[model samples]
Target: MQKRQSKHKGKSALAEKLCPVCQRAFSWRKKWQRDWQNVIYCSKRCAKNKITKEPKPCE
Candidate 1:
């Protein structure tokens, strides 16, 4: 006999975002739920690199 299926199974269609640094697609995560709008980089590495590439102020 076949087992019963869950109603919520395979329904977790998470949102996706594009990473500016790697130019790749990334999916939404639970930790970012509250600050999804504020999220920019997909990982810490990307965020760190972002700040390093900023233009320097005039001396």
Candidate 2:
């Protein structure tokens, strides 16, 4: 018997985006399929610790 082809492609073929909070490259995920455009953080931790204000310069 032949193996069935999956609807989804390989990981390398998936799209990628940089996480604003961690500045790391993240690939598309099944959970974010519908809302991939709105994803900004790599993980929940980064989302919670997102930068809210610019860092103050040392005097």
Candidate 3:
């Protein structure tokens, strides 16, 4: 049997995005295939700890 080729096999860098909450880069995941565009946080913990209020600008 032959192995199937993955569309994202060599596009790792292109499949990554920064998490707004942690300000860290995260790669694409199979579980997020259906909703990759809607992904925001890197993990559940970050999602839970997401900022609720906007920070006030310093004068």
Candidate 4:
């Protein structure tokens, strides 16, 4: 009997994205497959920091 072939023969290339807050390169993940387009920050910490670090308008 012949061995079955896999749908993915080799390692799939992981897409990379830059984090807005940390400014670091991050790779794609299975959990973010559906919402990859919406992902901007690398982690929750960065996301939270982004909200607090926003520049305030002069009064």
Candidate 5:
């Protein structure tokens, strides 16, 4: 016997993740932050190299 398949296969929109720094929406990914839970930055660079490091007082 032959098998049948549906027209729509493996077609789905990616989940949007918010960035902690910029606070913007971004595309979802796998392997790297696949969990998509408790995400910090939108990009690797942003996450790796954070703007604020030391505790500095505001002028």
Candidate 6:
């Protein structure tokens, strides 16, 4: 049987667990399993806004 690690031992950092855009806790699911780290926004709209605000790749 697959064992779940202790919450305190694995991915326990609160800063790494929240969405940067909405500041909401991330809901774990199969879809989010892979992009958990890159998940800055809770939704696509926020992600778009972040990209749009950027003047360019390099200034």
Best by TM-score: 2
Q: Which stretches of candidate 4 lie over 4 Å from their true place?
A: 1-12, 51-54
**Model 1 lDDT on a 0 to 1 scale:** 0.81
Per-residue lDDT for 1-59 in model 2, tens only?
99999987789998899988889999999899999999989899999999878888899
Q: What TM-score would every model get versus the actual structure? A: 0.65, 0.70, 0.66, 0.68, 0.45, 0.41
Off by over 4 Å in 2: 1-8, 53-59
Clashing pairs in 5: none
Per-residue lDDT over 1-59 for candidate 3, one digit per residue giving the tens place of the 0 to 100 score? 99997765465555898988999999888799999999999999999999878888899
Q: What digit string (tens of lDDT, one per residue) describes model 6 on residues 1-59?
A: 99987756444443445666667776554577777766667778767755455566775
The lDDT for every candidate, in the order shown, is: 0.81, 0.91, 0.87, 0.84, 0.70, 0.63
Q: What is the lDDT of candidate 6?
A: 0.63
Ordered from best to worst TM-score, the candidate numbers read 2, 4, 3, 1, 5, 6
Give the poorly placed runs of model 5, Cα more than 4 Å off.
Answer: 1-12, 32-34, 51-55
For residues 1-59, could you state the per-residue lDDT of candidate 1 as single tens digits?
Answer: 99997665342577888888878788888799999998889999998777456688999
Query: Candidate 2 vs candidate 4: which has greater lDDT?
Result: 2
Off by over 4 Å in 3: 1-8, 11-14, 54-59
Provide the lowest-lDDT 10-residue window in model 1: 5-14
Error of 2 at 39 (Å): 0.6
Whichever of 3 and 4 has more lDDT, that candidate is: 3
Q: Of 1 and 2, which scores higher on lDDT?
A: 2
Sorted by lDDT, highest first, which candidate order results?
Answer: 2, 3, 4, 1, 5, 6
Give per-model CA RMSD: 4.0, 3.6, 4.9, 3.2, 4.7, 7.4
Candidate 4, 1-59: lDDT as tens digits: 99998676343467888888888999888899999999999999998888566688999
